[model samples]
Target: MKKLMLGNEAIARGAYEAGVRVATAYPGTPSTEITEFAAQYDEIYAEWSPNEKVALEVAIGASFAGARAMVAMKHVGLNVAADPLFTVSYTGVNAGLVIVVADDPGMHSSQNEQDSRYYARAAQVPMLEPSDSQEALDFVKLAFDLSEEYDTPVLIRLTTRVAHSQSIVALGQRADVPLKEYRKLPEKNVMMPAMARKRHGEVERRMKALAQAANDLWINRIEMGDTSIGIIASGIAYQYAKEALPNASFLKLGMVNPLPRKLVESFARKVEKLYVIEELEPVLEEQIKSWGIAAIGKEIFPVQGELSANMIAERIAGKALDVRPAQDLPPRPPVMCPGCPHRGIYYVMQKLRLHATGDIGCYTLGALPPLKAIDTCVCMGASVGMAHGMEKARGRDFSSKLVAVIGDSTFIHSGITGLIDVVYNQGASTVVILDNSTTGMTGHQDHPGTGRTIKGDLVPPLNLINLIKAIGIRHVRVVDPFELEEVEKVLKEETQREEPSVVIAQRPCALLSKESKIPVSISEDACRLCGVCLRLGCPAIEKKPGGMYINQTLCNGCGLCVKVCKFGALRRAGE
Candidate 1:
């Protein structure tokens, strides 16, 4: 049966058909839907692990127990799972193991555009790239087979366009493959120095065998066309190149790593001009050039952002396509939602002139104009560490003016270790956990603290206050972020402490919680146009020509603006 499916959804379907019994991932865009879709299948046990590292480990454990397992995450998440990723190559697997990594070339929803293909090479594992949803399904099943055949973990790489784009995929029947028997092989599974040395040699031999067989692999095939030019591309890049140069001879790569060196050389010899088309990094181009093949790549094409059909046509074909230019539109920067609970916390922090080291989440938007509260945003869980570092550098008096802002999900991901570091080192740091009741930025996936499983089954929620207290932080305060006065008081009190403390801004996400209060209004008769309410940066609060007014359509009636207004100008309707 053929059905329209996203690349991520297709991956899940592929895993199910490939006899994969376990799927795990931490919620991240361009890849989160893979595990979510997998969870819908009764045959597959799926979970949302606390972080990428834990997610990969869970999949590894499942694979060790003789179950076909898969783990998915965005490109950056790979860095967090790198420790196990490298070692897994040496230890191999008892059952098939697959890792799905989605790359965001244009930084559409990511911090960086680091390519995952490099990870495959660094780990000495096979990597597959798919052009569309159909190919995504086929490649994943192929990945599982290749993993078991070679006794090595396999990686499937996807880009933002391919992962999000929809296409027709032909469904297949699930293979009821029996689980392999698990053996207690310490020499094989354990990574002690002596055992690792033996396994490292085995990893090298397996890679050599894979490389030798690459040319015969069905996934790396050539399409004959005009011999004047040939383009070697993979994943979405192949799609773009195919659209731009339909008449050119093409070498479309499904297996990107273990790069079919002989096949590439043969393709290079067939055409007078050869171009390597890829996004972000020159992984393929650098390797082809290393093999003494003369290829045109990053010299003519850019190494930053995404490549397009227009760009390929203009650069390689020397003719610009008749594509219409985008119209000049007003710049719409991302902002906090009208009734976002995190907004009140940021506003209070800004009012107190506190420096906030932010982590990855919707709250990172606090660094933008008006609130301008966050001082630095590096990555997930970096906020706590950076905040502690700043305090130690400048001393306890300086810590009174600084705070680390992280979401509840993020705090659980990697921030807990940083918090522990502060207590162990005898440093004073104020950590603020924005408990928004869901992973807001990543489409509200449940975390451990959310008291639900990936399948939405009820589970015991991890209490944040108890966890913080157990971590040696004595002063832990929970405040409703909508109560601006209370949030401000707690923040001030926590930051003033000479020891490590935590202040949790507890509230459900505006989308998750229905608003009961009436939309706020501007009392123009009692109003002074002081622009204080505007400082809250709520989209609901707007400045009109005559006076500042509330945009009722945009307002959630949380009354954050009303609390900020000093002149009794902004008030909830009928209040």
Candidate 2:
């Protein structure tokens, strides 16, 4: 049966049909839905592991037990899982194993656009790139087969466009494949120096066999057309190229790594002008050039961000195809939500003239217009480390003017290590963790601090206070961020300390406040015309001709405006 499916959903369906027995992943955008969807199938055991490293390890363990297993994560998450990933390549697998790395080329919900195809090459594993939802489903099933056939984990790479886009996919019946018997062979399972040396040779042999398989597989095929130009593209880029130049001969590669060199050479010979269309890094282009093939790639296409049919058509215009008229598009910049709790925190920081070092989260919106309080944002867990480094370089008094702001989920993700660095190094930077009780930046997925699992099972939440104290921090305070005076006082005191400190601005996300019964309203009496409350930047607070008004529908009753109002014009409905 054909049905409309999201690329992520198609991956789940593919795993089910491929007789997958186990699936694991950490919650990350463009990839989170894969495991979430997989959990719905009764035939598969699916879970959200603590982190990418743990998720991959869990999947690897399942594979060792002789069951088909898969792990999914966003591109940056692969960096965390890289340790196990590289070694697993040498050990191979008892049953089929697949690693799905969904890449964000345009940094859609990511910090960097590092290519995942490079990981496949570095790990000596086969990589598959699918163009659409249907191809996504097909490639995943094929990936499992290829994995077991080669006795190596296959990498299924998906970009933002392919992971999130919707397309029609033909469903298939689930095959009942039994687990292979596990054997206790230390020489094969254990990675000692001697064993690893032998395994390395095995990996080389397996790669050669896989490359030969790639040459004959229908996954990488040639489309005969006008011989004047042959376009070599992979994944969604192939879809874009097909739309951009319908008449061009094509070499669409599904196996990105260990590319079918023989097939590529043959395709290159057929067309006079060869062009490689891909996003971000020229992985295919560089490899083709290495094979002594003259091809045009980044010289004609951009080397950064995503590519669309419109972009390709425009870039190759006059040279290869006619230019299409530019279509009018609406402007939609990402912003903090209407009643975001981070808004008040950033507003207070701005008022106090504090230079803030920000971490990755919804609070990163503070770097945008209206507030603009955050000075520097590097990556996940960088806030505390960045602040410490700055303090050591510039001295205490200079650093005292800065505060490091990170989210609760991000703090657990990688901030704990940086926090430890601050305490051990004797740096006097104050770190404020915005505890919104959820991973608000990525669709409210639960994290280590949330006290809930991906499947909504209750788990003991990591206590940030105890963690801070254990890190040797003497001063640690938790304050409701809605109280402006309390927050300002805590900030002032923490920054004055000679030792590292932590201030958790504890409050549910404004979006989640109603579920927690946080207060919301504005009083018409005790009115003053002052607009200080409006400066908090909560969309709930608006300015009318008479005075500031609160939209009850939008307000989470977090009382951030009430704290900002000196005239007591903002108050709870009953108060």
lDDT of 1 at 140: 91
In model 1, state the lDDT of residue 72: 98
Provide the clashing-pair count of each candidate structure: 0, 2
TM-score of each: 0.98, 0.92
Residue-level lDDT of model 2, residues 1-575, one tens digit each, is: 99999999999999999999999987788798999889888899988776788899999999999999999999989998999999999999999999999999989888889999999999998999999999999999999998888889999999999999999999999988899899997887899999999999999999998888788999999998999989999999999989888988999999998899999999999999999999989889999999999999999788789988887777765544455766887555787776677776787788888998998888988887668879888877899999999899889888888999999988887888998998887788999999999888777778778888666679898888998999899889988776777888888888888888899988777667665444466566677777787666666677888766777667666666776778887777666
**Model 1 segments more than 4 A misplaced:** 321-329
Provide the clash count, candidate 1.
Answer: 0
Question: What's model 2's overall lDDT?
Answer: 0.87
Residue 524 lDDT (model 2): 67
lDDT of 1 by residue, 182-240 (tens): 99998889999999999999999999999988898999999989999999999999999
**Superposition TM-score, candidate 1 onto the true structure:** 0.98
